[model samples]
Target: MKPQVILFDLDDTLTESKQKVSDEMAQVFSRLLENNKAAIVSGAKFEQQLNQFINFLPKDSNLKNFFSFPQNATECMTFDGKIWAKEYSFSLSNEEITEITNALNKVLEETKIIENEISYGERIENRGAQITFSALGQEAPVSAKKTWDPDQIKRRDLQKRLEEIIPQYEIVIGGMTSIDITKKGINKTKAVNWLSEKLDLPVSSMLYIGDSLFPGGNDAIVIQTGIPVMETKNPKQTTGIIDSFLKENVV
Candidate 1:
């Protein structure tokens, strides 16, 4: 079915695999904004995600053009402050945060995760309420990342163990050997669901495009609700999807 509203995944999708959102994607975003039906539903936090694409946007434009549906916080509008079009954020307790941090650090420190020169970023990001345990330390090479965790079994196991230590928190595998820990009842799928209901739309009427849609992958949970899914690969493909969606539907 054609969707009424379309959601986006920033990283490997609109941006290249390297997570760089190019000028081409920026133009596509401007087009989507003109249509007023595009939103970014990504794993990155609002502040961090906005930092990536905000420069490409016009200075006078409102920040609501993009949406950052992080696992821990309610969806944050790109330019808008914390409370945006809607609120579905979940904050972690101090004790829960400390406990998970210690456990994740211990596991990553003890194991040798794949690291490649193409890799960029960090091994750990305590995004305030959420903690990301990255095997590649956020700097593993692209080629190495593709082979780092093909089966996802290892990461899944890590999630299970982490959950055991802090059952109250939400644990899920994410981008290239990274595990995102959030407060209970928080997940990408949940964030989308919350947004859909608040916007008075149906689940089936939305499509989420993300690179992490594979099983045990961070965005996999959204597939459970039967929302349309798109595998994020090239930025051009994301542009094509958005253009196609616009051509097929009026909004």
Candidate 2:
């Protein structure tokens, strides 16, 4: 049976990291939204979500069925016909932010991963609800991000270190080279539960698509909700999955 709603991870799953959605993927996604509720949950900030995914959709697409759960679902935005409105947002306190940044810096220093000469843009970004540490820097090229941690070994090591330092926060590997830190319970599982109540649907009625569903990956948290999931290697695989859903006329 087709899922009543589809949940997706933004980067890598729907589009290449930090890149805009392709025209082909946009068309298919628009069609998916025509009859099914869909949501994007990512560790990225809301602006990155818009620039990379939402802005590429066709004008006539069903915005009402679209939802944005940025910052690893620490924040949620829903379309209200006229505009996207924030449904709820969880923010880190000043002290929490300071501690997280300081811990990240300590980890970087201990790991000796910071290469100032090759790094691009900000290495640490405070997204209000979440803090992210991008090993290759936020503005690193897509190719660089991909090669930086293909096996996720390097990131797993960093994640382990961060966890040891800030056990109070939620820390997980995100995107190609980013590690996302959120409030203790503010992870993708929260998004799944929120949608289940908001849509008045059972968890089994939803299907989640993501690239990072493996152990220690950010998307792994959703597994606790018991939502069915499809794992993809990249955007191309995600497009194919969407195509199959459309072909099957699965809403």
Winner by lDDT: 2
* lDDT (Cα, tens digit) per residue for candidate 1, span 121-173: 77667776688877766656767777877788778777767766678778877
Q: TM-score of each candidate? A: 0.82, 0.94
**lDDT for every model?**
0.68, 0.89
- Candidate 2, poorest ten consecutive residues by summed lDDT: 111-120
Stretches > 4 Å off in candidate 2: 115-117
lDDT, residue 217, candidate 2: 73
Q: What RMSD value applies to candidate 1?
A: 3.6
